[model samples]
Target chain A: MKNQTVLFRSPVPVAETATIAGPKEKEGPLHAYFHYTLEDDLLKQDSHEHAEIRLHVGVLKQLLNRAKLSPQEIDCAFAGDLLDEIIGSNFAMRELDIPFFGIYNACATFGESLILGSCMIEGGFAERVTCSVTSHFATAERQYRYPLELGCQRTPLSQWTVTGAGATLLDKNATSKIKITSGTIGKVVDYGIKDANDMGCVMAPAALSTLRTHLQDTGRTVDYYDKIFTGDLGYSGSLLLQKKASETGIILHNHEDCGNLIYNRIAQNVESGGSGACCCGLVFNGYIYDQLQKGRLKKVLLMPTGALLSKTSSLQGESIPAICHAVSVEVIE
Target chain B: MILNKEEQKVYKKEIKDVAPKTKHISTLLRAFFTGGTICCIGQGVNQVLGILLPSLTEEDRGGYTTLLMIFFTGILTAFGVYDHIGNFGGAGSIIPITGFANSIVSQAMEHKREGIIFGICSNMFAIAGPVIVMGITASVVVGIVYLFL
Candidate 1:
């Protein structure tokens, strides 16, 4: 099947979850939901790079502890980060003795990792799989945009990079009721957007395309999912998606973006809202997961979007290309 | 999922309305006055240097004033105060020699952990590189034209 949606006959259950965030994120609206929060972005580490590694390790370790399983007991670990070469996930996974699949899909990495992890379990390749992603504001800023010392003023359209990490443990034996039903892998779509500062605008089209495709592939309507969430489209992207989706006659009534959900839009100075790979990771694992566990929410269609632009491409006057992957999770009581 | 040419045209137009728009007139006024104030301060520094170094030539005094501005900007950048000026002043903080110093020193500080040679020295010219390249090129062109004339 070429770019077909995967439907699991035997649903894989979400066994455990953990999220670790920085001080800035802890100050946001979802602060109470995080499993752990750091006092500083650096986490007392010697450098921002080291701090990013600590974020990944912290979430993975916390999830292991919560699940009461050792790292050696896990069948596989799928992880990623928004750094050059995904150094945060790579370096952190070195501490775990389990088989590691280092993945990268920019901000959409969590959705990518989740789909793959579910496939591994459903295919009988692994019994227990851990999926995780990490992103640090300081580290990401230095790599993608500019150096911290320059203190360049961020444009109003710019989305703040989320400083956090999120991990979830999935088991094939139906240990927990929260199960992944289906997923749709996105294709890279470019709409000729050149501005690097307005990432939300660049990514919205991809999000819309994936949303429409996911619904079509699964033979589901907008009402099928209780909540539809996009990764880090922020305020502008979410609005743009709503506008575009309506034009195609598919209205998303219960739609929200992790970028918009992570912070208080009116109170916080997060211009367009939170972004980065960890934006969705933190919100879904922290806020959305809590809502589901409490039986307040049931079916969720989580689509994490990513703009695939490197520093080199953006510098060379290239338009931004984006992708979004959709995964449906339901609490089957 | 790539868009066709027709689809792209529609997206480009739609996105223009979707993206945030900044007011140009206000920003321009702020930049102009801020930049003017910085030049005025440089002139003031030049006058003070002339009084302190009475025997120095006019050319030497001008050179010293530039050095002083660069030094002041570097210190300001280190203290993280220059960023506020840059934010409010726009081009005002960036058009002067101080802005040039800010760029180099700030970049060096940012990459300092990578080591002196690979980190600091290598990144020292990142923001200033294009400016240096164009400046030298323009000078060479003007020099040749003058010679021919």
Candidate 2:
């Protein structure tokens, strides 16, 4: 391992991916790429939490079906969500027979799971692994901010929590050209931002920190990858990251944020952009994965950024600490 | 990663510079109109009550108007309309008695799945709790001052 980065000798192939987007996300530009789109976000469940769990289960099942593998064939699964204690992933795992590892790093959970799953495959610990994440707008709203029906106005900086789940299946034996090449673990970076609504500003520094570390460790320039995709740094946040990166002499010419790409901000009424754990999950598994498969994008760096702030911490006036994990995916001949 | 005070200050300033500024003038205008319309509706309700019951005291009409506003807000909240009003009106919709009803009603609806005691009842005041506390505290202080006077 070179500092925080791991270069896999035998790159694990991404065999299959499945995504289930919500009603609102279904209307987005990349709607056609998703494997399934929910007719109703509630899915007839009594609560949004249960609906999120169901979405998680649906995506996992879809991945298995696409890969033609049973739950028994999968050695282990890594998953997480934005919910307290990660109940979305936990309850979903209960319905599946695969061994599970429940993890959390806020919205960057998908990246953490990908890195860990790839490590398991590269280390000879597991032959086949599944990494998944989920998030629901209503559930996240009730937990992190105001109730769904509350007549409180959203701040201009506030992001809409994405309602969806995505899962990726990695196999050592799969002949897929798309493979996990390397990964860089992020350090928790806090620049003393207190406003939870301005998450893009909060998480942008962490994304920049991880991106810098990844470049330093790999000895690669910013142009090494076709694009560097950050998780949920809505519009303003991505601009902040770009400005800050350029200030440090690292120009982010090919940087795009999943939050920004997932929704039409003005038309969708998502003030900033789409956020939550599934923000990157859906975009990566659906849109980015499709691009890679079609050879439109050969090399890509996926850096999922997370803001580690709880309701109690924000209420207590503690600053938000953020983390970002970068996994380089490439198409190998 | 750690940054010194100076670096933190610089970064904070950069964040502020990058963030999109809120449209203050437009927001103020919207708030003014929305709040004024709501107050007008309250007055209209009071007048209707007065005409309906000629013998009722002024205090009774005032109390009933408040009740009517809360009831209307509760219905709008249940039907999921007030949140959109809030989205457009911003502070206009949020500074009225309707907003208070919305705070309590929304919480109750959100926590209904957790069961009555621990869910709806406990969380009902999640947002309104602070407002109620501050109101009572200020009122008590004023009452004591009046007693001395």
Best candidate according to TM-score: 2
TM-score per candidate: 0.95, 0.99
Q: Write the per-residue lDDT of candidate 1 for residues A38-145, one digit (tens) a residue.
A: 998888888899999988988999999999999898999999998899999899988878899999999999999999999999999999999999999989888988
The collision pairs in model 1 are: none
Clashes of 2: 0
**How close to the true structure is residue A119 of candidate 2, measured as C-alpha lDDT?**
95
Error of 2 at A167 (Å): 0.2
Every model's DockQ:
0.56, 0.84
- CA lDDT for candidate 2: 0.94
For candidate 2, what is the DockQ? 0.84
The segments of candidate 1 whose C-alpha lies over 4 angstroms from its true place after superposition are: A1-3
Cα lDDT over the full model 1? 0.89
